[model samples]
Target: MSAYTTRQDLPGSLPAAASSALRLGALASDERFEVTVRVRPRAAPPDLAASAATLALKPAQQQQLSREEYAAAFGADPADLAKVADFARHFGLVVLDSSSARRSVFLSGTADQFAAAFGTQIEQVEHAGGVGRAVAAPLSVPSEVGDIVEGVFGLSDAPVARPHLQQLPEAQAAAGASFTPPQLAKLYNFPTGVDGSGQCIAIIELGGGFRTTDISNYFKGLHLPVPKVKSISVDGGKNHPTTANSADGEVMLDIEVAAGVAPKALICVYFAPNTDKGFLDAITAALHDKVNQPSVISISWGAAEKFWTPQALSSYDAAFQSAATLGVTVCCAAGDAGSGDENPDQGQPDGLAHVDFPAASPHVLACGGTRLKANGSSIASETVWNDDPLRSASGGGVSDFFDLPAYQNGAGVPASANPGGRVGRGVPDVAGDADPNTGYQVLVDGRRLVFGGTSAVAPLWAGLVALMNQKLGHHVGFLNPLLYGAAVGSGATHDITVGDIGAYQAGAGWDACTGWGSPNGAKLLQVLGS
Candidate 1:
């Protein structure tokens, strides 16, 4: 379902800045040729079939690794092997597995390397049937360029399992959620005096089509000011709606939430096909939008950590930085998988470590998941929220490949104590409601689906940031360095003190489950307001 375009003329590196002319996502100034690589699936064994998390090969497969026949050929485990496996698994490659071998792997390095890995000859690389160039950065933060940032703190006090979102009575439910109580409402010192009139937020999506009719209906129900929304395109062209998922719902929720919090802001939605090429192109196009140029951009779609190459990661960091330069804050989903995505690429679950990306990249703010306990209509509490194990949970952990950026020098994130010696990056700097069961209700075309995922967290937080921007009349560009410093102890954030996300247990102060807990809307306004 994806294509890889090969570039023979260019080096095996992506540009710190883009030069492609053919735009797919919307930001392309040049038309670039891409080779298309069709994504296909392979079979895996029974026990190993759905279980994508087996660390060493399965007992039966030991011969495959031990035999000099295979080991010698593949090398002492290809250096890139770890990277490739990590990348593939992160992208749900395993889910595509049949009932035989393992999943097919997609290699992003040199052709010879891919051919060796897949045991195939290099035909033309496939290009994502896309139309936009992937933008790298919006602001250039040379100093923070090389380091991995710190993120995600846990809250152990919110309800882990709760009631159904669909069955909730329409009369009791309000257009949007509100926080009132001890922690969340307290720290969420929302700057009541703030207004987002001069600000704009950009939403990037694939596969979901949202209609103006739905928008009118939604706001009318909420009784909020009808937002000024503009649609842009890349390959797909102009105003349109694609498909729906937690990611799409989350994007819409954030837009509405931000508008609700800061009514004066304008919203721009950039819809692209949800392919790699389309994803990249959409972002590029969104960046180029001169009219409604977003002061903030929120992306909720991505694969596992290693799916992207260093060049790709760098490109994204650069893109976010570019946005930072423009006073834009980029927020991303940490992932629905737990500490490690249980063999995300494979269908069967395993207890291994996996992280979601571009969230893992030091540049963007990684958003996590949480559950809120409320009475009548007010948020009673918010805590680290997640589904049962091997199911889905907020993604939080340390990175293996990246070194801690200097900005992380004193942040509480410890040097990862894992076998992988690299300084790790803590995911999900901040979190919001991502529990699918207790998910948000949204409008797509005409119907409403209550969906949730880490996908929802990113945009929700981004919208909050927009509201904050409206309040301060200033953008909080690249907030990691500031948020992670000592803000955890500050009342700026509500300490979600309940519940647990499968793997990690939430507790008193910052835990891995719910990072620094959920926001206290009114309080957040006050803190940011000041």
Candidate 2:
């Protein structure tokens, strides 16, 4: 076999039409660019899907393994990484850092050096966010190095996912009876006695920051313990809050909700830039963080599947798969828009139903939204979230990229949609209270704000998973198989049999709008504990 292989074709997300030259004027040859080389795993567990399914039915203890054990079983080969580093040095690039598992090799060099090394143009591209630099074409490397480099990220610094948090206006009439986090937990029958002690919930953020004082004051008012929060920066991103945007709403809401539900659980927030490199790096850092060793991670940011390249999707999904092997549960918000998931301003269609990525990825739990009404702690009624005229609702639909996983084989996932004959993965796997009319109250940068989106649902489920891990005495890694299995027919979840989000309607068993429905905490704990 030839020692080299060409890089895979770039996704449609980075179209040829995006080739307008950046306005930065003549590029300096000495200007350096940082890039991450993703190395392919030496060997993938051939039966990984089956193994995850089996483990989902068994206790967490049965499949749990230490970081060292996981790395030995599935990380990239050391020899392959050495070849990549040598190639970087051969082209006068500096090898900044290489992960212990050799999965990610970070390198830096001038645009001249990179252009010479990869045989690609180094230029900035114009995007909706602003002009950012990127490789104008597919990168090619020496045969020896190309054989192992799965993909090269950070080459094109395009804007990443947007926070799914939606701020509701102050004047909107309070529809459902408002409830604090604790009160909401009670209404859902969350297990008592386990306050998520001894567990760390990792929260991934692309932008925004959280203030300690706000977290302290809010929790104090509720008479709950102020959860310990830690910040870990990735890819040069920081925890800076600016007055220009409401992005901070996402940062604070994630922490407040998870902490409120699991007061004693340590919360570690990983802050990164809003770019493809930053997003993927943040997730990889969180998944492999030995210091935090979070058993559960909550991500409230995502873009529609159509916006991601095939290469980007595969790389990101691989990270989630690795998390499953390490016994970590990841919860991602489906999206805030209805089935279309379109951004008219971005030239995307308004009528086509598209699901969000990460959420749409079968490995992570795709959490949708719902409007819940309660009469003094007893559930009054709940329905799929659809606040029409306003044009906001929970995101649910079949994916155009991924196929249905084995776990969803017979859970009533449909095989057709508005873009008929397109059979793919159905999101979400579960849902939570996310309607702005029935939204969670959060304090962002000192302002009391009401926000709703599938965003809040991710952290809500993360807290529940943290509590379950604490109660069960182990982590519950990948949840879909179990969710589609034993946890389905059992009394663990509430089936939302009302309303429609757009292309899909809520029904008895499973539907795109609500998945297997929202969590019924107490019953869920009992079933999973056994």
Candidate 3:
């Protein structure tokens, strides 16, 4: 007894790699789990295009909406939520939770129940991340609710992304030129007299966790007060710190680097599973959390555009759009694997250049990497971070998914170096020192290790944004449009004019490798403040 006699395909619901995965067996019928259903927004979002233009030209004139205001205006429709909940009841699935602000409904049921509800076969599949569950075919929903449903996630729990982090070997780490976060802040000339006292930085972590003892000891070593840090569990993910070789490195690095720069800024970490559903849920939760009300968010995890589903990409981008309207800035790591975001040891498996997602999303502040040499407190040399083109390097290139945005018009962004040579949005909107040979010294699992990658760069930029927000007396939401315009010629950045990253090179003003170069904090603050 279903609500509708017919069914329709859920757009962008199938993972690109699903068909290629090694078939293990049918999923046990009695196995139980949860899935998230994304409902369409109540109405079309506000004119973000016009808002972006204004934010670039006259940030002071831009109007920001609070969390409550946004929900009331753009959240899901009550009637639509009721229809979805009724549909779930018809299929014997329990409605675990629902949120208008996030436009999501959490449903729990057995594998057989989900298979019946979505009109798909659940099966065990072997992917790079090991055995997991996935739908053997495209997901479908009751025709009555098809148009109202944006996506159905957690049907497939394959690993979605890897942490964009690189740690040097103990021997090399001990011998390399590494600097503490404070030293880098000084070199970059961050604005003085502001410690981000009133701002909250939201950090998204897919795996791993941080220890209180580690946070205390690390800050004590730096001679700085331990910033208040809190954790929010998403989809059952929590702060479970294991060993140094695990994702704890990424978790600790993000916290230490961001806190080290903005000592008094409150840090809220949202831990989620490394699945598409978990990732998206974590982002929405952070963006809509009224308690924390983060002014900026830092994401150090992502994969190439090719690995993601069309629905997941659009959904995540939509969440970021909501972030812009709420006057929140999101900083994302570009990638550590150069233009080819896959296994570097394999040498471009498909031979096509790729850019990491979330970073490639035009709405985010895409942070790239650099190698630096300092003389005293001033930088002697800075270049595109490329230690091995076939391995570690700053990921940069034209995006294959997103179109070229208006803000990059005068920046001379080049087309993708791949065969088709299609023009698209360029990446690494900003950069920072990320070479393991010239990395940041961080404490992970009680071990002091040197880490580098675009991962460090995300939190580094997030920390700077906190300081900027504190100084400007407002949130510097959606900073890309401004960065490409006024901040370009105003000495707000260091403009790296040397080196390359395999498929692309760096020179003059904006290039794929370093995107207008690293920060000159004080100058950037002045430009934004004006």
Candidate 4:
């Protein structure tokens, strides 16, 4: 891969077209420049076909594209230009000057002209979000599926499970488990001598600002310490006023999970509004986060590939690399969407990045989700969490972009999943509680909801990093090398033993879904302590 195109960074949530370029005019000259642009989705009306729980589109607005031709538009990332170059070269599509985070960039030439030349519709290239969301449809819940699974597993069992992770698990209440810091800390115990008192843990959230009152209430309710949480806003996005959004819900879960697992650590949240610009800007700010000097940053947001560009990846590559030099460990969600982002169309490399972007970046750690069943003192059955195509799934799969990093080779993970087979870089390096049906309990704007997704895993891992820093005498910058080759018997990590997240089934060893399984907090501390 050439330097201009060899970027292996995690693709971000920003639309993919935002980074493209082109050879403008009838005469291809250096004067013909490229500009970043976006292909926004037209509003789709509410229908039974909706897969997303968040706002749905208005309807089949395909005709909306014919009039999309524009005489002017501007201000996109240089990446948008690359998209133009890449797409045009691949399909002879023209490049347009107009750009945006939502609207797809036009190729400037008339749609009919492009159709005449390429034999393909040039006006609207489908944004894969809807298509990707459809892949999990196979996992949809059978109205009685949760009951059947729970019944067979026996809900009366100690520390049982509910259909969702974030919802109030009757098992948690029945087992007398409370979401207190110390009690939960055991789940992330640093090796015997570890402590995180001096380390910092930074959290990246899109919305759902935590209030001082909520902190007091949460801690007082749990009889735990009030974590030191500092709020930082990026791209000038302000603290959200509180609302319901998967983006914000995921953010809240990240903070609470990290805090619960590593209470004594300093927690700083970098907030960005729920937009691609704010999301990208927030991460850039986190990479250079001052005052906090956080050795670990946790992220839990993601979108499909094709939605991002190499330039975006290159920009983030710098940050991830910087964190590494600074000894910071970057953790991200592997997306809640599953494998190949499922496309019914055909097997074309998803024009998009896979799973989670930043997480897919070779510079960071990607975390996947799992559904777990625990008894009084032991984790009974654990499985890779996929939203029963019927329910949805935790994201996991190989990247069409990022190259395989050195840390990816040893883990029994086959080299084939790396289709486009040229690149390397595996994902969900480490994971923990992310089964929304069996997820953690929480309070957001005083509203209680059950939640789980790869979102919960990122921060949970960050909290573990804080404790590792406490024990190792410094931050455990990138944990992959350490976790990947460790002996299977090393009690430090638990190998997930059941269930399946999409195509990957949970087994005795590492699988694509749950990377070393969930942590054996107590033993992990013992091993890391050594």
Judged by lDDT, which candidate is best? 3
lDDT of 3 at 216: 98
The TM-scores of all predictions, comma-separated, are 0.64, 0.93, 0.97, 0.64
RMSD of each: 17.3, 2.8, 1.6, 17.3
Prediction 2 global C-alpha lDDT: 0.81
Model 2: pairs clashing at backbone N, Cα or C within 3 Å: 4-143
Q: Is candidate 3 or candidate 4 better by lDDT?
A: 3
Deviation in Å, model 3, residue 277 alpha carbon: 0.8
Q: On residues 151-228, what C-alpha lDDT tens digit does candidate 1 reach at each position?
A: 000000111111111112334335445331112222344455555678888877664445677778877776666778
The residue-by-residue lDDT of candidate 3 on 306-418, one tens digit each, is 88988898899889989988889999999988888776553335667889988998889999999999999999999999998757999999998888877887779897998
Candidate 2, number of clashes: 1
Reference-based lDDT, residue 98, model 4: 30
lDDT of each: 0.50, 0.81, 0.90, 0.52
lDDT of 4 by residue, 1-530 (tens): 12222212112322343322221223211112121223212222121111221112111211111111211221233454354345443434455433232222434333333332222222121222211010100111122111111000000001100111234444444443333333335544434444467878887776566656666676667666777888887645556646634344655666677876666788888876544445555664665555666778987765554445454555455446545544577888776656544332223433332555777776677887777655544555667776553235666656656655555555565443433444355666667766656666665656555566677778877887787777667455645555654424686677766666554555666666777777766676555445
Candidate 4 Cα deviation (angstroms), residue 74: 32
Residue range with the least summed lDDT across 10 consecutive positions in model 3: 47-56
Give me the displacement of residue 262 in model 3, in angstroms.
Answer: 0.6
Error of 3 at 443 (Å): 0.7
For model 3, the stretches where C-alpha displacement exceeds 4 angstroms are 17-20, 47-52, 345-348
Which has the greatest TM-score? Answer: 3
